[model samples]
Target: MTDTLTVKSQRRHLHPAALRIMHWTNAIAMILLIGSGWKIYNDEVLFGWLHFPDWITLGLYAQHGLQWHFFAMWVLMVNGLCYIAYGFYTGRFRRKMLPIWPRAVIADIKAALTFKLAHDDITHYNAVQKTLYVGVILVIVLQVITGWAIWKPVQLSALVNLFYDFQGARLAHFLGMTAIVLFLVVHVALALLVPKTIGAMITGGPKVTADPDTDREPLPSPAE
Candidate 1:
């Protein structure tokens, strides 16, 4: 017989139903908002060469794009609020997403940079992931605030004033969207790097196999 031994992988329930629903809803809303927002941004292209083409935009014109953006924004806002509420209700904020301490984040960052970072569990997030998740929530809030201010500078005078001016709010909104796009890239890459992660998001669990790398512990291998 060969020296290598074969064993069946173990499956664990990772994302609950509510979590999956919220995750997908947020994703769809973000995609729509970004597409329409890009169309609107093209109306007054700050940098002429940086505009998105007509084919990829949600709407061909600013007025139409604004309509789509407003619709998506409301959905994103409502879904985000629901997700936050569920996280609090189920203690997910404390149990999963809490970054714990400042030093932990620094330590995690160092480990990641040095290629020494390995996950202890598929169900749990590393400090860096937790920190990013928390930061993204703040970014979403900023996007909403800036979006409202830009959409109605005169009507929402008080909110617009928070950013000092309409232009300031517009700049903040643009920057926030950029951060979100970057986060999406990293998020998708990491999901692909790890097996069954996306499947877990869709189906509530991932089939975890033995971790062959010795630098880190195995992923809970069951006895053969």
Candidate 2:
């Protein structure tokens, strides 16, 4: 019991203040982008059956939506770059999100499905969380590239051609938006299910000594 208490006492703040600030900033930027993007999409939807209603959308019209989208785009870009730099410079990504073995991912998936996944140690990310975080980062990068292609097809003709054409970039951007929305849904659901995570992000949670041994090593292969 004492040993368990000692181990728990080793937990530091789950999120640093800088990260939390960037996180909320990114969240606000994404909300604006999505809302305005929806309004833009409604004007000439790729899918006729999937038009967004005005109440949920950001801007009054497509042109207005474009203005909002552009503003949010710059915000997301600057904030995301800062996040990337901080993650690398602080070794936060390496420490918290690396060594994500496939076996570990599979095990975590099974555990989650069985409702046996552990959240007692909020300090560590499960393999599934790591995978989703990395995937969303890549998806966001793709969204930015595709967005540029759509924004200035004539000036960035090379980029537009890379995606096949203007319509293609639009399609890619829409798909990326869908991916981000799905990630948000899952992320929010998990936060609700594990409420402490939200608190950790908000008030920085309980503080303790830094634990150098916290990082998860790769799971051994089956053959081993």
Candidate 3:
């Protein structure tokens, strides 16, 4: 009998280092902001179910919460700014973030709702993913705006006035936080649903199979 060797071709995608840094940084910042924000809100009555003592004294006072909130906001803002700059400079934003056609987005949304893989030929984000990604980015920007409206009311009074009042800004900030929480829940659920996706992000590459019958091609690695 003759011995045979098999060669497997794989595709690389994602920038592991960049992704790791951004992911962990964002995660930490979000956690800090949420915790501190909750503490501050507990000082008043936003919802009955969310109640905490006005003075916890466990290194989580309202004043301390404000400090942590601002600190974490800066971290998220700076990191996000850098990520955006890199995306534009490297042209990845154009490739990955530019909205696909409405028909394509609708198709992807239908496929996702039906739990099917929509595009076999496309390797990058599907239309639905692009829309969600863009939506999350806009949400984050809104968070910054509302956050500033609360943080520096005197300096940003004019901007805050657009929203109506400091109370309105507070409401906007709370809503933004809630949206982020919901997004995170869905994102994490999807990650659990798609194990390969988690692997791709971690390994910076995707496993591929070669077959003459299949229409899908290997995904390309993130540009150097």
Better of 2 and 3 by lDDT: 2
By summed lDDT, which 10 consecutive residues of candidate 2 come out lowest?
Answer: 215-224
Which has the better TM-score: candidate 1, or candidate 2?
Answer: 2
Per TM-score, the best of the predicted structures is 2
lDDT tens readout by residue for model 1, 2-24: 22443333223467777899999
Candidate 3 per-residue lDDT, tens place, 85-176, comes to 66665555666778668999988878888889544333478887788778888899899989988888999899899879988888889899
RMSD of each: 8.7, 7.4, 7.3
Candidate 1: C-alpha RMSD to true structure equals 8.7
State how far residue 23 of model 1 sits from its true place (Å).
0.4
lDDT per residue as tens, model 2, 1-224: 46555555445566777889999999999999999999999989899799998999999889999999999999999999999988776667887788799999999999999999999988889999999998999899999999989989999999999889899999999999999999999999999999999999998876745544543222112231
Off by over 4 Å in 2: 1-12, 211-224
lDDT for 41 in candidate 3 is 86
By descending TM-score, how would the candidates be arranged?
2, 1, 3
Q: Could you tell me how far off, in angstroms, the CA of residue 192 lies in candidate 3 after the best superposition?
A: 1.0
lDDT of 3 at 97: 76
lDDT computed for candidate 3: 0.72
lDDT of each: 0.80, 0.87, 0.72
Give the CA lDDT, 0 to 100, for residue 24 in model 2: 98
